[model samples]
Target chain A: MAVSEESQQKRRDERVREIGFVHQVLRRPEFGAAAGCVLVLLFFALFAGDSGLFSARGTVNFLEVSAQLGILAVAVCLLMIGGEFDLSLGSMIAFAGVIIAIPSTVLGWPIWTCVLLAFAAAVIVGYVNGWLVVKTGLPSFIVTLATLFVLRGITLGLTRLITGRTQIPGIKELTEGDWLAPLFAGQFGGSVLVWLADQGLIDKRPDGLPTVQGIPVSILWWLGLTAVATWILLQTRFGNWIFTVGGDANAARNVGVPVAKVKIRLFIMSACAATLFAAIQVLSVGSADTSRGLQKEFEAIIAVVIGGTLLTGGYGSAIGAMFGALIFGVVQMGIFFTGIDTDWFKAFMGAMLLAAVLFNNYVRKKASEAR
Target chain B: MAPLIELRDVSKHFGTVIALNGVSFAVRAGEVHCLLGDNGAGKSTLIKILSGVHAPTTGEIRLQDRPVQFASPRDALDHGIATVYQDLATVPLMSVARNFFAGREPVVGWGPFKRMDWPLIERVTREEMAHMGIDVRDPGQPVGTLSGGERQCLAIARAVYFGAKVLILDEPTSALGVHQAAVVLRLIVQARARGLGVIFITHNVHHAFPVADTITLLNRGRSLGTFAKDEIRRERVVEMMAGGRDLVDLEAELAALRRNGATLQ
Candidate 1:
């Protein structure tokens, strides 16, 4: 007992004093993602400063883009951690958008009713995707791939059938004074930004508007949801279940974890995230098109992967995905600021994703297996 | 006292193949009952039924003399029965503490604002591992870094910590070296001392003879018989395991073959 007590004391001391900054950072699965975020920011800031990429206005511009993708990326990160995928997520955004827009604009439904209806449709699609994957024992990739095409095809066909044009219009007029509209797409900090510009603290746009006019509410949504996701992943029993199911489904089942339920919930969450993104898009743009969320599923998955989430599942963080979306937003918008030909964008993105995945694998090996 | 877990005349069939037939096994508290068998000798089938992986086709299982039906593995676990399979049932990439308190992790605070009790988890994991005679310096370390024997120890300790009345270990020592197998046997003795009814399953006679209080021999899906340590000698048990083909007869055959080969030379 005396020897054991001494060893226990030694362990306690080590726990308290041995967490070096380098070790602490290396221990985190998202450390590489955090470093990559910094590298991307530095690259854009250095190469594109002349176009005001480092300015407050420029920051908010990229933040808006990141927020939209960040919402989807965060949900994708959770699903990936739960050992599943939803390739239908991107099409879900378009489907939800069209579902909301067609009813609110053409069928004369209230915006609130339309939003709820769209969410309900998303829930059903999400449930079906999860149920089919679980019951059929098929890979979620193939299952959601079918959903992707089916949802997209239906969105395109239905939009054309109803409105003659692929795009639905007159949303701004229908939602002119709706209370829920501003919460979803409203801008804030406008007066404060205008005051700063008037005092010459920031630049004015060529249209005579202040550069940092206001911050998009979606940024708030992004930060808020990221916090919630982090909490769910780290603090809850459900979070532990996610890690277990992803790590090994059979072992999880043996230990009494409801593997099917956790996976189904994750799928539902991914679809709901797609719908949330659609809501923001439709409300902000005042219109919806069949191709509104084109390629968004792949983009969200790329962002999640770049954020240090394992494609095989069981290890990742929502914060990493948040940082990944920021990197994507900065680079995509920073190219415009740099006056570079946008044709090289896809190649550049592909290279960045490859580098991030390689770096994450290296970090995972070091943290998991190495002494 | 009644056995902690008892299976009476249990038989399981998958279509036409009878995996286990009329096998009755009992493990009393504070006793180590070793189940011995060769490969495909219905050992896997028996343990699966005991751990609720599969229901017995025709039999009754009793817990402390009361009949019990386990609908799922969770139901078995809830009734104080736990199983540690050959694979150790661990997530390699997860931390020791996380793997320890995985499915039923303790949480603090209220709904939508709750968090894992990390302090409690780390403390309990380290303490429990130490109690099991393994000093885990850091519970935060990934379980994959531990040796195979250490992983088995961790799994056994986890079962004990979860209030298991009966611990069923399937081939826990099959993959270990000499020293590691000793470590697992030591853990089994420790568990028995702690009053847990341990079902130690292995094919090695040497492994079973030392730590087992009761021995159950299985062959071709039927139990040869269950024997107490005093009732059976090591040589006799080995003969029983070899299907009554005594080693003396085998050696005589080998000698006759050698003489013929020598004459031919």
Candidate 2:
């Protein structure tokens, strides 16, 4: 009789005690990433406190690195949320760099034209990557992995064939007065920074210059892209399509969402982001190398995963990826400032990634499990 | 009055295989037309054609006595023919409001300021679920949290709200328990009362009998003819559904086996 009483069925529709506001906040996809970001900052502050890591100059140094990676992260975040991967993103950066450098330096083309050409090439490559995945029904991983090798090979082979050297130089002088170079390579907010330094708000160098000259345009791009990507994810009709497509492509198709189109556009978005990365690097550094952007795709994906995007897709946040990339840049530089073995940086990041994923898993179960 | 939707001697073929053959079916507004079939009975094929996932190899589909062709599922939806598939009704990870308005999201403002009307969406989602007698305390909750019956009701509510003239449900109750099945059957009746023609597909006679105004049996790849609810009784429907007296023969065979076993014992 006791067993029967325990097993008795109740009406399934009883509106259970409502979950509290705090519980609801805990359900956000960005909760883990945001927490991890603050924890990373706290940890570094303790370890590297005396190394000037908190100084404006040093802060901007790490932020510049984060900004560059964040550019790729925004695009990768969207594509991942739409349920595909473009592993060639890293290779495309190197390829786009050469496309920008070779044309402007060797062929005497304008820097702006080379940048445009690089973007155009990226669109075609992205189209191919998406087409193969959509039409052949191959997993995007395998398709884009194949693309990775092809792009890198082309970058190396074409650079060697054309210039007889792996590196391209002499593009810096051409960028000095170039109309488009400042958009990608230069900095802004100099007057504001100088004013701050005059007011003793930030440190000034021995030569009467501010320790940090200005904010990099790359930082602006990163913030702008994150805001736009977040808007797309949260508000637009296409945003809803992306979520449903990733959540269940078959179900999305049944409900009349254009799953293929969403995926293909996402691929193109990531490719253009790669070109943007290359434009910034190749212009600012004043050289191009065949080996640039190696393992960057993995880095971006890791940042996205740390930011709380599902590895399997369908759920994530751009703000989360921003913090994920910030954590990456801070930790990489934090080891240098703290006098830890530089080689331990990768190991530490790997550990951080594992921890982030585990935390995300725990939070996911908490958010979705039965009351 | 002409039926809201009619399949006139429609047949479908996939290369050499015949999936449906000359299956004539009609569903009028204000009725639940139950499609009863056993396994491999071409029920899936017939509904696929009716919902515009596939075109008939022969014959025609008429809406209110006018012929129409649907090139895709979206086309069918545009023409007010909505289908709620058994497993393909919703994306589980998305919020109930998001899933309710998955492909057709309503927006406000203009240009870059245009965005999903979350307040409006949440209100509509809550109101619609309530209309279907489902209690959804939070429209922002992931749809996966809803019980199977509630999810089915959400799908039905979505189709009904989207102006579905003829609703196609593909084996909506086959995976549900008795209680859940009854709930879904109640939704079918509600849809009928709203003057929308409901195509209720199932193999279970018990589930079909209560809501069905017209019973249409499918066997192999053809229809056994349609019958009004008063034209047939429960026992006769069951016998006909069991491949025409095969159940009687099966019962006799079981009895013979029992007698032989007793003798041996």
Candidate 3:
């Protein structure tokens, strides 16, 4: 009884010296990115609030932009947490767009079939990327970079050879009244917009149409994907596998985790995300261009990094990347609404990235020092 | 009786640097087999072979007298051989419960809705830590915050809990304190009582002697011999180990260095 009592006292002392509540909250990877989101929002609300940046029309514009990037960022965030990079994401977008367009606009196939084909192509590309990296034992960055260039070249060469032009147009007409078109390319909640306009809560154009017809489906996709990703990372056994594979793969393997399969599945997820991005773009824009989705891969990666995912991997959060995407969309459109030269946007991204890294480092150090 | 797991005349040569040469041993159910050796006495190589990290260049591994070969670590684990390594034990960044069930997590629901049973996981982790006499404040706490001894205990407990038959621990108590080492020794006894064939690899005879049913000595990639604890006195096993001469040589060299130094003068 005396020994147990003494040990109990020691445990109590150890608990007191352990991490406090504040330190635990601060140590979470999302804390810095969520804070950054708040600060950016505050800046925009003060500067661009009067310039219609918060208006229904302007809000939809930026949210649509965020939603698109959020989809890819969510996938990239998972891959990064699994300790890999897919540089071919941007090229896959362009290539999948061409794949969707060539069938629907040229061969006159059904829009649904074209969508399926694009998904199929993405699966093959993803599997090969995963296979090469796993089999060759090369860094994923190098293997996917090779894929990036090859996919871009193939997209360009194939489009010009068959269509005699770099662009495929008139896809909008073909998607009209198609049952499957609305899932990837349309607005939701039109009745909600109508009701809001009727209640005088939202603006309506002179023609009696709401300035923003409805919320874009992409935002729905973004939130759904984020929720799902968060669920996978937190609630599922596969989520645990991903963390283990990224944290210490040799240890994970020793404990019987299938390291190769986890990595391959994550790579496949990234490719599918790019394909979804392409489908949304192709159906909405009414055309597929070789230049579509250029540099989107880097943008998604920046959003993920700003979200506080370590480049080295094994630790991060999906919600943080969501806030990271939100911050990005707000700032990009905020500069436009505030009438700053748009060229300065890229410079701001660089500064924000550096600031986020410094802040994350500071918070991590402080959290550790507190204990 | 046939052994639960047995290695017969195993030889492993790595580019002419022979790590193990014609070594043989057997671990039976309900026994604690202590492997005593120096740092480079083929103990690691032998463990590696048994754990399926490396296949023997020439040998036969028989499980219940049935010859078997493991192609990978997973293959070894599938055959109910769980190995807890010295360095790569538990993932520090992971939660204690998650680390406890890294590959084999208990799930609830069906198909896509299947997920980790959070309440059960936490409860099991806390209960298991308590069983091993380690007070875990929270099952959700990252393993990194634990002291070195606690982390070692967590790894050993994980191995003991999940190990179906054979439990191979490589220097499990190397980083432990006196109290923690005692806790691990007691846990080993419990595992053996539950019909586990434990291969406890350590250079410390003091740690090995109390619980070991059989003691095997190795030196320079060769097995000196295996003896029942009755046939081997605690001090005699130390003399037969590779470290006996090496420690004496190290002390003599240190004394000569002291003689050459100005402080000695």
Which model scores highest in lDDT? 2
Write the number of the candidate with greater lDDT, choosing between 2 and 3.
Answer: 2
Task: Please state the CAPRI-style docking class of candidate 1.
Answer: medium
Question: What value does the lDDT take at residue B32 in candidate 2?
Answer: 91
> Each predicted complex: what DockQ?
0.56, 0.54, 0.53
Q: Which candidate's DockQ is highest? A: 1
lDDT of 3 at A146: 99
Clashing residue pairs, backbone N/CA/C < 3 A, model 2: none
Interface RMSD of 2: 2.1
Q: Candidate 2 chain A: worst 10 consecutive residues by lDDT?
A: A9-18
For model 3, residues A207-311, the per-residue Cα lDDT tens digits are 998889989899999999999999999999889998888878888888888888999999999999999999999998889998888889889988988998877
lDDT of 2 by residue, A117-142 (tens): 99999999888898899999999999
Candidate 1 chain B worst ten-residue window by lDDT: B239-248
Q: How far is candidate 2 from the true structure (C-alpha RMSD, Å)?
A: 3.2
lDDT of 1: 0.89
lDDT of 2: 0.90
